[model samples]
Target: MLNTQHYPQMISPSLMGEWIVIASEQEFVQRQQIKTCLDGQTLTLHRDTINGVHVYQVNFESLDMKELNLSVQAAYGFVWLCIGSEKKPLFQLQEYDVEGARRVPCGAYGVRTSPLRGIENFLDMAHFPYVHTGILGAEPETTVKPYKVEWREDVDEIWATECFFTQPLAAPSSPQPQETEYVYRVASPLNAILYKVNTAAEGIIPADVVCLFIQPLSETHIRAHLLMILDDQTSSMTDMVLFQQKIFTQDKPILENHVPLKLPLEKLEIPTKADALATAYRKWLITKNWCYGVHKNTQEEQVV
Candidate 1:
C-alpha cells in the first residue's frame, strides 16, 4: 500500500491529488499499450480506439484489473492520467486569448532527479546564460532583474511577473535575437507554466504558454512532460519539439548531477535576487507540509 505520509510533494493533498503523465497522445495512439511504474508497482495501461473514441484499461501486477470509462482527451497534445480521488479538481491549462494557437507535443524525458529539481531549474532565470548558453541566454547580459512574486490567495497559486531575458533563439520560428518577456505560474507543486513573448508570430495576443508537468516515480526519479501553446505560424510541430528538446537536453546533465537530490527548504548554498520566486515556492511547500523530496535537517522539527 502507498503511504500518504511518505508520498512526494507532487502527490500532496494540499495540491489536490496525484496526476501523472502516462503517455503522449501520439504515443498512446501508436503503441496502444503504456507501461509505468508508480510507487514500486507496475501499471500496464492499454488503450483501444474504437469508432474514434479512446477507451482505457489499467492492469496492476498481482492485483485486480479494471477498465476505466474515462474518456481520453488531448490537452495541448498530451495525454494525462490521474490516480486519485474522482472528487478532486483536475489541473487545467490556462486559456490564451490568441486565436489559432498551435499546440506542440515536446517529448517526455526520463531524468534521474527529483521532481522539485526539475521545476527549480525551470524557475531559475539566472542559470540560463550559463546552462543554456546562447540559445536561451548569452554572456555579458547575465543580470537577473528584480521580479515580483505574489501568492494569489483567491486561487491558491503563485505568480511571478516582470521577468525579462535576452535570447539568441527565443522561438524556433524566429532567427533574430530579441528580449523575451516572461511570466511564470506555479499552478501546483509539480506543475508550472511559463508565458513568454512570441516575437515570430503576428497576433494581438500578448504571449505564448509553455507548461512543464513533472511526474514523480520516486524521490529521485521523475519524468518531465512538456507542452506548448504558441502563436507561431512559421514553425512545424517537429521543429518546435526539437527546439524545446535541445534546451532540455542541455539541462538534463546538470539536473541529474545535482547533489542532495532532495530540495532544501532552508539555508540555500547560494543566494541571489533572482531566487525570490524559488524562495516563495519553498515556503509554499512547507505550508502545505509536503516534504517527501526535501532535505531533512536533524536540528529542525520534523514535517509531518
Candidate 2:
C-alpha cells in the first residue's frame, strides 16, 4: 500500500462513489481541521483569530475557506437540487432498493443523489429574489445590497434578506398551538441560525445558534445537520410549519429536475459579475479538490 501514513486525512466517497480525501491538520490536540472542495476548486484555508485561540471560519460571501462540515455540505446539496434543472432519481432511505445497493447510514437529513452537477450558480439565488420574492425579494435593492456587505477575517458578514428585518411587519394572529416550533439554518460546524416565520412576513428573530454538522454519504452525496436553540416559548406551530412547507415546496419541484452530469469544474469559462458568489464558492471548493461545475482557472499544486 502507498504509505498513507504521511497523509492523515478524512476519507469518504461522493454520492457517485468517487473517492475523496479531506486533507487537513489540527493546531492543538482538541482543535481539529478539515477541508472541502467546491466546484472542483481547492481553497487555501487559514486560522481565524477569535477571542484568542484559532477557530474555523469561511466567508461564503467572499469565497474564503477554513474548515469542513458535513451539515453545511448537505444544506448546499439540498438547495442545489431544489433549483437545478437536470433530472436524476433520488430516494430517501425509506424508499431505496435494498438488494440493488447497500444502504449507507447518513446524517440527520440522510443522503440522496449528489445535486452538485449541472447547476447554474446564481440562478438559485435569483430564484429567491423572484419566487419567495414576497418577504426577502420585496425589492430589487435588497437582492443586491447584501452583496455589498463588508467582511472581517473573524466574523463573516451575512446579510440574509430572510433575517434582515427584526421587527414584525404584520400583526400577530390568534392563539397558536401548544408545542414550541423552531427553524434552524446552519452553514458550518460552529455557526447556526434559528427562528420561526409566522403571520405574513413576521415572526421572532433568530436569537441563538446551536450547532452544525456535516457528513458524507457516498461518492457524490453529503449530509448537513443543524441545531438551534429557541429564545422563548411560544404557540406558533401552524405558522412555522406553513413557512417551512412553503419554502421547501417551492424548491422541491425545481430541485428534482436537475440533470445528472459532472463538469470539469477546472475547465469552466471565465466568470462574470453574476458569478461573484460562485467565483468565491469555487475557490472554497478547490481546497477539497472536488467540485461540480466547470472552472476555467486551475491552481497548479507545487510538488517540490
Candidate 3:
C-alpha cells in the first residue's frame, strides 16, 4: 500500500507539497490595511468576513506547519490563508517574514551545473554529499536508506521518510545507531523547506536549523531568505549572523546568476534520474490543477 502518512500539514521545514490560497472581497479592504500585502496581487488574494470584518485570507496546505504550533495571538510569522471553493478565504494565519534584517526562507535552492549556464538541476538527495561537501560530504556507503515510512491526509497531512544512518567511527553497522538527525519538512504555499540537523548526547547538544525561503523576485531574478539557528548549543546571535552572511555572500554571485525555468518549455528541456524529486513535485502540482504555462483562476482548479 502507498504510505500517505509521509505528507506534512504546514509549510515550514519538515514537509513538502501543499496548496496556498489567498483572496480579497473588495478593493476597500486592500486600501485600509496596506501592511499585509505581500508579493502584491501576484498572489491570488481576496477579502472575506472574519469576526465581522472583511479581512484578507490565505489558506496553505503543506507539510511545514507541523513545527509551527504557535498560539493564534502570534500573528507575525509568514501566514497562510485558506480560500474555500467560493474563491473566498476562510481565515488568516501569520508569520514574520523578516528576522535579523535578512530575508527569511521564501523557497527553492536551485543551482547550476556549469558556468556555460546551460544545464540546470534542482539539488536532490544524491547531491547532498557532493555539493555540500564540508557538512554533508558524498558518502555512498553511509547514505541513510528509508525503512519504515508513513503517509497521511488530514487537516495536517504528512509524507515522512524516516531512516537511520550507519556511521563508522562511533556505532555499530546493523540496526543503525542514530547519530545526527536530519529532516526536510515543507508546510505549504511557499517552495521552501525547514532543515533540521541535530546531534546530541548526554549533556552535549548541537543543532543547526534554518527556515530557507526562496521568492521569485521576477521572471528572471530570485531571493533567498536565510533564517538560521545554527549551533544552538554553543553559538550566539553575533557569531551566527556573520557566519550565515558569509555563506550567503559566497553563494550570492552564483545563485543570483542561476537561470530559471521561465523560458518556453521547448527552450529548456533536459531530464534525468536526478530530477526524481522535481518530477514528483510536478506531478503533485498537476494534482493541484495549477495553471501550467498559462494563467487561470486557482479556486477553479482545486479538487474539492
Candidate 4:
C-alpha cells in the first residue's frame, strides 16, 4: 500500500529541517536528472531549459518520482534541498561576494565516514603536520598555538579564532614555508568555512575562504563538496583546484578509517588541548540534540 522503500531510513528532524547540499550546481547540466540521496532518503534532480532545477522523491502509491515540493534553492555554487515541512534559512558567506575572487569547486567524493567526523577533521589543527604534511604543515612546526572558540548564540554557529600554525605551504600563493593564521566557522551542522589570512598582502587583501559542505547519504556515509573564494592573483585556477584535491586525497583515507564510522559523542576519548574546536563542535551538536551520523555509546550500536 505504501512505498516504504522510497525513504530507506528515518532521518533526524534536525537534519531534515536544514537546507542540505545535494550537488554542486555544475552537476546539473541541461535536462539531465541527477539521482542522489540525503540522510538515507533517495532523491532525483531535474533541470529544464525554461524552468530551474526541480527535486523529487518517490511517490507512495505509484512508487514513481514525484515532486518533493520542498524548499529548493541555489547559492554559492551548490544546489540545496530542505525536505522538512518547515524550512530553515540557508547559511551565508559574505566572502563569496568579494570582487575578483577566484571561485573553485572541488569534490563530490563518496566518503565512507560520518559527516560529523569529516567536519571535526576539518577543524583539527594538530593533524596538519602528520596528515597534510608539507602542504598544510610539517614537522618542527607542529604546535597548535592557543586559540579561542566561542558559541555564538545569535547565529547558532561556532567560531574559532586566534588560531596559528606553521606551514610549509599555507596557500597556493605562499612564497615559501611560513606561519599562517586561521579562523574556522561552523556555519551549520553540515557546513563549515575556513578563513586563512591573506599572507600575500595581509591588511590590503581579504582572507581566502574554503568551505566544506556535506551531504549525509547515511549515518556512516557522506558526500563532501568544497568551494573556495580566493584572492590569489598568481596561482592559476587549475593549480588551486589540484592543490585542494591533493589535500583531500590525503584526508580521505584517514577519515574512512575512523573506528565505529560515526562519531561517538557520548563515549568520546579524552581530547588534547589542540582539540578545542573539535570538542566545541561536539558540545554544540549535543546542545542541538543532533542525532544524525553520530553514535551515543549504546550497547546495540552497530560498528559497521
Clashing pairs in 1: none
What tens digits encode model 2's per-residue C-alpha lDDT throughout 9-61? 43211222221212222222353433344323333334445687444432232
Where does candidate 3 have its weakest 10-residue lDDT segment? Answer: 113-122
The best-first sequence of candidates by TM-score reads: 4, 1, 3, 2
Best by lDDT: 4
* Candidate that beats the other on TM-score, 3 or 4, i.e. the better one: 4
- Return the top candidate by TM-score: 4
Please list the residue runs of candidate 3 whose C-alpha ends up more than 4 Å from where it truly belongs after superposition.
1-123, 138-151, 155-160, 163-179, 201-208, 229-231, 246-260, 263-276, 292-304
Report lDDT (Cα) of residue 27, candidate 4. 84
- Error (Å) of candidate 1 at residue 295 is 2.0
Task: For model 1, state the Cα shift of residue 144 in Å.
Answer: 0.4
Report the C-alpha lDDT of model 3 over 1-304, residue by residue, as the tens digit: 2122453321222111222321112223345332222221233333445787444533222223333331111122333332112122222212223232222222223322121111122223444344444333336544535433222334221223343333322111112323444444433324334333444321222324455443322223333434544334344456556545544455545544433323222314464554443344444434444332211333221110
Models 1 onward score TM values of: 0.85, 0.39, 0.45, 0.89
Query: In candidate 3, how many Å is residue 273 off?
Result: 6.2
* lDDT (10s digit) by residue, model 4, range 115-196: 8998999899999999998989888888899899999988788999999899889988889887889999998989999999
Among residues 3 or more apart in sequence or in different chains, the pairs in candidate 4 whose N, CA or C atoms overlap within 3 Å are none
Clashes of each: 0, 45, 71, 0
Candidate 1 lDDT, tens digit per residue, 1-304?
2344554432344323445555566777558887876544566778787898776666666433232223233455555555544323446665443468787768789888877888988899999899988888999989898999999877677899999988888988776999999999987778899989877777745688888888666667788988888888878888988989998999999988877766888785566788999988888888878765676666442221
